[model samples]
Target chain A: MGNDALNVEHSSGHSAAVFRETQDSEQFRRLKRKHRGFVLPVTAACLLWYFTYVLLAGYAPDFMATPVFGRVNIGILLGLSQIVTTFAVTMIYVSYANKQLDPDAAAIRDRLETKEGVR
Target chain B: MLHLAVTAPAAPGDPVLNIAIFGLFVAITMVIVFRASRNNKTAADYYAAGRSFSGGQNGSAIAGDYLSAASFLGIVGAIAINGYDGFLYSIGFLVAWVVALLLVAELLRNTGKFTMADVLAFRLKQRPVRIAAAISTLVVCFFYLLAQMAGAGGLVALLLGINDRVGQSVVIAVVGALMILYVLVGGMKGTTWVQIIKAGLLIAGAGVMTIWVLAINGFNLSTLLDSAVETSGNPAILAPGLQYGLSDITRLDFLSLGLALVLGTAALPHVLMRFYTVPTAKEARKSVVWAIWLIGIFYLFTLVLGYGASALIGAERIAAAPGGANSAAPLLAFELGGSVLLGIISAIAFATILAVVAGLTITAAASFSHDIYASVVKKGNPAPGAEVKVARRTVVVIGIVAILGGIGANGQNVAFLVALAFAVAASANLPTIVYSLFWKNFTTQGALWSMYGGLASAIILISLSPVVSGGEKSMLQGVDFAVFPLSNPGIVSIPLAFFLGWLGSVLDKKKESLEKQTEMEVRSLTGVGAEKSVAH
Candidate 1:
């Protein structure tokens, strides 16, 4: 395997022991709650948005037919916006990770590894 | 089934340029595979690309892997034939990335290494879940591969001037042989580089086609749409009635197809396997972001390519081509750009198939060697190189089966098969992923039930659906054998699979271990105690 960290696991149980400790820590629980709080609402919102577009396309042909501009109907406009929406949402989450999630998460990692190293 | 059993369309020139372009693409790809095979000394090197890929490279590779011939040829062909309805597929396919990028990538990265089996078996009882995971992965891969192989066989015949069935069989054999070699020797790194290069070429090639199409129409989309509506004689060129909203069955069918495309993309085993190629969860997320961008752009261009085909060549002529509407893209290339451009476009489409085939082959090989053979068959202690050896042999077997299957299928449209593949992925894989990662109470019983339940229901529903049973559009079209109302089964099978998973977990009454859940959560969230990479 190309993983030195994984190879070491068979010789010594250090990573597993460290993981057990990290799992028991309050910080871990906090991280889980924060992540769930962010991810669940986003998932729900995305699914809801996607289904709305699909359901509209399936059930309401006239509404989709109404053109917003000359020869550019509402359906075409809405379809194009789906691409825009994906990009916008992905960028939002990426920014959220950069600004909110990664920093705190990295701190927990560094602290746990240092304690393990000292031990 | 390879639709368009008829010969390739009558382009102005003979097959000289197309063959040359295709040969050049194959030669360059072989060089890449040769370089990549040298690094395949260890399991990680073979499977994860030594975790050496930068986020940008992996991201492009992901896009390449995700956008198969279906996106390039299928969607365009659908649009050319069905007008506005074909464009709806682009919306559904792109929307799927939102789920993959925001919700799934982090969890997949935290626990998964090598395969989706890695993620599912992370906290669950390993053996049963791994076995179930491997089986479902293979099933999905098999169907997906069959679709790709059929499409590739048809494509090869178009490019090489192969007229007879025997010639098509030879083409399938050659494709199968090359794909097997890439997986058996070059591994994921080789497959990935090929995908990245193909993605670049596809984007560039499609970009030029889109621009030239617009140039023909004086850079006005409405002009193109107007010509499309007029030529196609489909008033619903910019409306829903052309493809969907016609009848109750079609409406439901559209809904089901939309559901599968929107949900099934992330669940695809090959696409998911790309996640582990990067080093960290952050890189995985970024890779997804990149993929969404590229795929989104590619599909946007497809809008022009599809509509433009109707606008220029007229949808009737495109539909008249062998393989029906799928020839729209190639026909468009022939009409506007002549034989030279058609040759390049054909080469790119062929590369798209090859890159995807290589990706699928590697994932199947990984699932077999890592998930089943090493983890299940050998009880997690494989002899040195035994797993890799098994992986190599599996690739040969899969390649041969795929080639034979391609030859066996009568020429029919395989676009529906891609949708069915996605439906299977959504049904069989997605529920397991969602429940295992998020639901703390999710048990091994639940995981097994979801995978098997989803797999069986998807196959059963698809067998009963019109795609396999109804008319010329159906596998058994002439005789009325289909009892299922819809063509795709995601509308029914997906919800059933999720419910089965929930019911199984609730009923199992397995001993709850909060610590195990906590371990997975901590590692998944903070990226601590996750699998690590060592440079080769």
Candidate 2:
């Protein structure tokens, strides 16, 4: 209800048409592809890694219990690695988004907002 | 369950010192909240703190909001008693941020205005989607509040040596009242400040204790573990299965709980609502990064503290304490620095409850006011200031309800309540949000089906699960209605909700308008039109 862009859609349909055009544009397609392409696989891989750890902790206690270093077993190491991987993935995504995603998004956003003068 | 009869050790620290520290914290946060609330004249200010918080600040608040007493006291206590099994929970909770950061945060920040409903209802039929989202939000908040409230009763009673039920109930009421005051006076702005302050104190307190614990063992983690092993007389604690490895059924239950904890964070309504307090999608991303680091580091501290507690105080004492495993951190504090340290840590724990409850209350209030009252009840045309007024009233109503519910649930094995809240959020909210954000073909019918069906299945399964009735530690005594084996319904309900969402969308012949979908997609991905609406 507070959205002028949505209100514009109901009133004139011009902004809606423009939105559809932008949605179909090659740049927008590229943006979506780049964003989802990185996010989806990374998400799947991280989740797979995490669930694998969970399962090992559940079903394979002996393997996890195999002492890796003094008093620290594979389970403790694996748990620590999950934390490491979380921080690693977060940093990777931040850099990736900063370099690969934001500029394209800003360009697309600026063009639309400038044309509509919604601000 | 047999451990319920174990009397707690003579009160660990000075109760007078604990009360003094608690009073000091309450007074300081109250002043900050009142000062911060001066600018809250509009609905946006009330709900989103005028989008004034930086990424790092919001990150601290997020960490504060996310790290309930359950994580601080509960996980540490778990590790103290159960060892490696307790560490699994920390891993699951930390890894959950990946899902939030990569999939939900930025796009949601771009698409929505106030609550999770704003994102889900963006391209769909607004009223139905908003109503459904509001219901799920309220339910999740209510359950989470119940857990915190029950924890508050047991925790404060244990600290102050109040053995009477009347004293515990009074403590719960006072917590509820303080929560109401924070939200009523500070709104999101005040609540966020409380969260920030609490997060700092919590992390700092944990960090000091962690260093102290490591120092006691000559800075050797292995030595600490060795001492813990010696003291507990169980090297099995160093390995998994001390808790969850007894049988295949418990193992499978661990898996279910893991599934819920990992997938649950992004869909949590209070957490989602925090994303709106930041200025941009990039800032939202930054906040998650900040939160992951702060929370991840905090959990790492919990691991040390847990091992330290087991090493110093021994597992038997922790398990036999008044609050059971939830007293591990406090006990460790008493061990390290006597009554003063114990007082400070206990006060931090108390602030943890107050801040978390305040966050939940404000979020639920916003949902009811913005989604249910303003959008649905007013038919999207309420007069100026009406929404904020409604939100204040809703906060009062929710506070009273939470007080009553907390008292009713006090002294019960309500740890399952928090897990149930996670299950509901993961099942009832996550699927629809993912579909709406990614799938252009998602419809109103699909949203309704996913939200309502997911909610119903989660509630139903929880009621029938061992957590509610059949088990020795269930909420109900001497009743054997539990047919479901897994305590958490997530492993079943999460996939079911996703399946129902896909099925409903596929079956619907009536599709949402393409123009609206385009607007949402463009707006969500690029942040266009979002700032125009959210800015002023």
Candidate 3:
């Protein structure tokens, strides 16, 4: 896979041609699919949950004020839940990337770098 | 500035002790910064710390950079005075990190070398895009600097009882000089160390205060809340809407504020620049994880401290203090352990401002030198070692400007400056960044349109909003030209930016280079070619 003739300026169109080949490869596509598959929905869901909380805090103050237990109300509980959700999502993403995403990405990188004589 | 009924100007603690502790902190960090700057030989060394920091170290620095005086002091004071409503800000700030971790951080680290401009200019027309990014970066940094500087002035006034206008101005100048020295000597490597030390001290101090507050209430959270409500004589303190629930318009303002906070963190220039300090994308990811935990735990501490302050000192006295609500934490420190704790905690607050301003100054300097001077003016070829020298000079200029602005803004409500910075970042930078990374058809024209359009609209809206004019608490006193109903512009400007990006790309007949786009996509998704540049 080593092609001495293909080595040129990193930003030139010739090197980008090699990157284009990697971009179209099945391995590269699979890595992108895996990444977007995990990240997109998780991001949308978190944003949705966050906005819902914000809207309720803004518009439905009465609901947010409803007491849950003793002094803890719906607003306080919902706020704490947001904290929990944030930490949980971070851990989930990290674990998911470690198990599902990183290996495929690393393999694809190895192939690209080796072909480009970057070893 | 609206004059709140203030308690008499009496120093809360031993002023001499506070000054001595603060002096010690400055002397120690200055030594560390001097040691770190010895390695600043290349542009990479000056800008990204030679990509030398581990994930954990970078994470701690990121937490330090991200948690400005706004997060530490402002949010703490907000919660102490306004009850549940104040906690909302912490939630927004924290949740924004999820957007950063999942969407922005690793991809950015893999793609960009030093500044945010490196990524945005990667596939677009370098000259126009780089200039737009540098301008947006400088504006955001200046706004944030003003907030921190003004907060410093107020913090010192309350902590040491320096009430005269001239004394506050001198304090601002001294802080400016220290920030200049940190960046001039340490560069990014030194700045990162200062941030790390500050983060540790800040979290530790807040943790101590949180535990002390909890113990006094028998370690029961409900007991703390009950005491807060009982002391304040307002049961509404336990619920939402004390701050933002006055009317329908005020409620809408809360939504706008929430929108800005959630979207703003990922786009903030200084915050985004922190990703480059780590060598690999994996380290970037790990750094974000560490940052989320550290920042999350710190916010939790603030919650207890907020209600703790209300419970211990009563809301009336906190409201009546010299800096108004900003005085809560220092006042609570005085109440908790008398002068000694007050001295220590106040010194920590000063350290927070110093760490943050140094971070901002270096970031702005990097933007000016890397984007404007080297890339744009020199047309991408400068004499060896010229870039770092230019950066050092830019730091001095920024320090002077910040001192002047801080002195002018002293005693004003600096909160809106922070809000404006966030809104501009969310509206201007975030859309362009997302498009360049995710949208293949994103053209140079689209990038330019979104960057300039979003920046102008956000700034114009904020300037005309109630934050700057009209109402009693506005920055400009006794003016009524505020046509924008919402105090924050994010709800409107963010969507507009995204739309402009799409429309501009579609309208342009000439498309951006497909090869460049493909290259960027591959580089960002995988770590190929990223590590080599980072190592350089």
Candidate closest to the true structure, highest TM-score: 2
TM-score of 1: 0.95
lDDT of 2 by residue, A21-115 (tens): 88899999999999999999999999999989988988888899898778888888888999999999999999999999999999988887677
Off by over 4 Å in 3: A1-9, A12-14, B1-7, B531-536
Error of 3 at B140 (Å): 0.5
Which 10 consecutive residues of model 1 chain B have the lowest summed lDDT? B5-14
Where does the lowest 10-residue lDDT sum fall in candidate 3 chain B? B1-10
Q: Give the true-contact fraction for every prediction, in order.
A: 0.61, 0.64, 0.66
TM-score for model 3? 0.97
Which parts of model 1 have CA positions greater than 4 angstroms off? Answer: A1-26, A117-119, B1-12, B410-414, B477-479
lDDT of 2 by residue, B1-536 (tens): 11234455666899989989999999999999999998889888999998878889999999999999999998998999999899888888999999999999999999887899989988888888889999999999999998998888888766887767898799899989999999999999999999999999999999999999999999988898899999999988887898999899899898888888888899999999999998888889999999999999999999999999999999888877888788889989999999999999999999999999999999999999999988888877778899999999999999999999888877788888899999999999999999998898898888889999889999999899988898878888899999998888999988898998999899999988887788788878888766422344
Report how closely model 2 matches the true complex, as a DockQ value.
Answer: 0.58
Query: How well does candidate 3 score on lDDT at residue A3?
Result: 13
Ranking by lDDT: 2, 3, 1
Ranking by TM-score: 2, 3, 1
Q: Which of candidates 1 and 2 is the stronger one according to TM-score? A: 2
